[model samples]
Target: MIATLIKLLIGLLLWVGLAIVAARIVFALPRVQDRIDSTALDPADVGPLAATLRVRARGQEGKTGIAMLRDGADAFAARIMLADAATASIDAQYYIWHDDLTGYLLLDALARAAERGVRVRLLLDDNGTSRLDAELAELDAHPNAEVRLYNPFNLRRFKLASYAFDFFRLNRRMHNKSFTIDGRVTILGGRNIGDGYFGTGPAALYVDLDALAVGRVVPEVSADFDRYWAAPCVHPVGPILGQARRDGAIEDGLAHYADDPQLEEYLEILEGSEIVTRLSAGDLDLEWTEAALISDSPAKGEGAARREDLLSARLLKAVARIESRFDGISPYFVPGRAGARAFKALRKRGVSVRMLTNSLEATDVLPVHAGYTSKRGTLLRRGVKLYELRRKSASRTPADTLGRFGSSGASLHAKTFAVDGKRIFVGSFNFDPRSTMLNTEMGLLIESAAFAGNLHDAFDRELDGLAWRVEMDGLKTVWIDPESGEVTRDEPGTTFARRVVLRVIGWLPVEWLL
Candidate 1:
């Protein structure tokens, strides 16, 4: 019996080894032929809207028109208006696009735009859209629309098996979020296309930020889209969905929303928005400033070894120029040793640094919270004024209009920072190792004191009701809520089971991936 058990164990090990080899060999084989002519569609052909925006931009003498999108309703309304107003082209890229209410509404608008002869190009990360393959292929069936995926897996059915062999390549993903219309206007920031981002989700709402930019920077954003659209890592959907198959799935899917009352109400709400009206009338409240659109090159993922090409490196150089104060906001704040040391060095130089991140009960990813808690003591000891957002909070003031109507819980997802009240950075670049080394990111750095001051004011006004201040009592840490003046020795609002899980996860050596 012992000999038979040993033989069976050996057979199992050999089978597993063979499976790994097979997976590697299959994934290594090229699944799609590289496009010979990798040229992008011309943005100059965009129509009269582009001409008007250029006239305005030239009037500002290279300064871009920037408007901060603080409210979720306003953000969603702005995108829908842009899609409706586009005359020639629309380009969009996102990390996540769910098939929920907001997602379908926006997609239906895009489909309508395509039907009217407007060219549409959509680029999405494969991992985020793994379940929407058929829907994306149907959308690609439109003659005026094209869909592409970045770094797709070869074996679509057995994704876990494929990951075992191609873990390194598949782990790196595109986390960019941007939308452009007519090559004239662009919206870029931390918000992805989903109900939670737009404040329509049934559960929690994400308090996020986006920048509506028009001017010379729009062309730069368009150029970035073009780069990604033409990269070798992108694969067209036509090849993924084989030929000789026309089932009208795309049309049928869209037809489901033809007379949707919810969609009609959303459209009505957008039409009545004051911001939309002002935008349509070309009377925008824009802070014209000299802004630099920074992005990591597509080659950053194609095995390029140059650190100079990294967005994080560029941001660090900007951070080095901070003179007095630095305020950072990130939902996933896993500042590894290097980041911690940088903050310490800044503090040593008499710079006041403050950060706002998610608390244990508020965070969606427990592993990330574990990594963050592990560094809480060191950061607090360094005199960093740290604040963690509460799971639920009451609205404080009129300026606390950062969420959607009826939003129950708030999750901090905005990635923004202010330097000495002189410059402001906003985008999808989280302060984590993954964003620093594994993914591509983009953002705008505006040299505007007014913008920076506005952000600072908003941060201050929302602090009392929205977050809990972290304080160290000798060796023990405490969370003090400013609104209620209540103190908690343990992680606030966390269940016992979750606390145990977090404690176990904290002991794991996985900070690099968090």
Candidate 2:
């Protein structure tokens, strides 16, 4: 009996030892070896025409129409241009294109472009377009247009195991938005094609931005598009569907659905779909600037730029170069300790800083809001002017304006920043860690005084009404303290579960993946 007990104890010790070694090996394999060196723009790549480009700052149609303010306007403009001209081909890549009015409008615009005898190539992430299978097959029926889903997981293509085998792979999504019009204009940035982004109606809207570039920048955008188009991950729609033979009725059903009288009513709700009206009405004053299209070149090594992944680094470098002041605004703010320290160093340099992010109640993602609120005290202590947006329906602010038949209120989704009234950065790059580390984001670094000043004025005028200033009281920060307006002090600790989850996540060495 004693010998039997000894044998059992010895076996348990061996199992535990093996488990520890296996865990260490698994963790070590995924660990990133080094930090990426920030890349710089090549002087040759800046192009000569950019030197002569004239840029001016223009306001949006209304507070609720902020989507028309950025890439939505540009994309709409490009689609129109393609429809009007473009005899050869058109290509677009996007991460998200919601199956709402805005998405349908884009679809209609593409159909019109095809109707005008233009070959249209639409590449969308599988994760984004999988649900729109019926819509996609309908678009594919077009003789001149082709819609392909990248890295599809559907069993129709013999990829059934891909669905059940791996779930984490889905999280590593194709978070890129790019479009090329007649190989002339290139629109790249973070704004997905949806009404929520275009200020259709404040349903947990995110204040985001995108960039539109003409001239030489378009080619770079085309290159990125081509890379993804050629990638094995992106399979042709015709071949995939050719195998599935999903049936002919799906197209007829979608056509009938499009003609539904309710769609007209739905269109009214999505003001962003009125791209043609805004463009024809001269809502967007096209600004030309000395802008060099910056993007992440394909990854080579520890610091090598990855495909459609370099824009984040370029934006950070631009932020780092700010000499006098740095103002940032985003709907989401998830800056960890290192990011907080970076802001602190900027404050230490006597740089007047201001930032606008969503409040707990204003945010749709409570956990993300919690992550941001966690850093409020740290940010406030460093002299950062942090503002949490308030619900405009409840509060009487000067910025509120009745928009779209008193239905939609303004939600700030504009990703813009101004530096000393000289340079401005606008596009999809956000201040959050997710934007910085994981997601591949794009935007324009505009060095135009006119653009910067106009954005600055808009922000100044809107902040007083649409947002509440975050201030430090003692150890905590407050958004709307019943007594002291918006003050900051010590915040409550995270729940035990959240703490445990965050601790485990913090140890993950996937900064490259973010």
Score each candidate by Cα lDDT. 0.78, 0.56
Expressed as tens digits, the lDDT of each residue in 152-204 for candidate 2 is 54444434344343434433455667766555445665567775665433344
> Which ten residues in a row are the worst by lDDT in model 1?
394-403
The best candidate by lDDT is 1
By TM-score, who's the top model here? Answer: 1
Candidate 1 residue-pair clash tally: 0
Q: Using Cα atoms with residue i matched to residue i, what is each candidate's TM-score against the true structure?
A: 0.91, 0.69
Candidate 1: pairs in clash? none
Instruction: Estimate candidate 2's RMSD in Å.
Output: 9.0
Off by over 4 Å in 2: 1-86, 141-143, 154-164, 201-212, 238-262, 265-284, 297-309, 318-320, 393-412, 459-462, 480-514
Question: What lDDT is obtained when candidate 1 is compared to the true structure?
Answer: 0.78
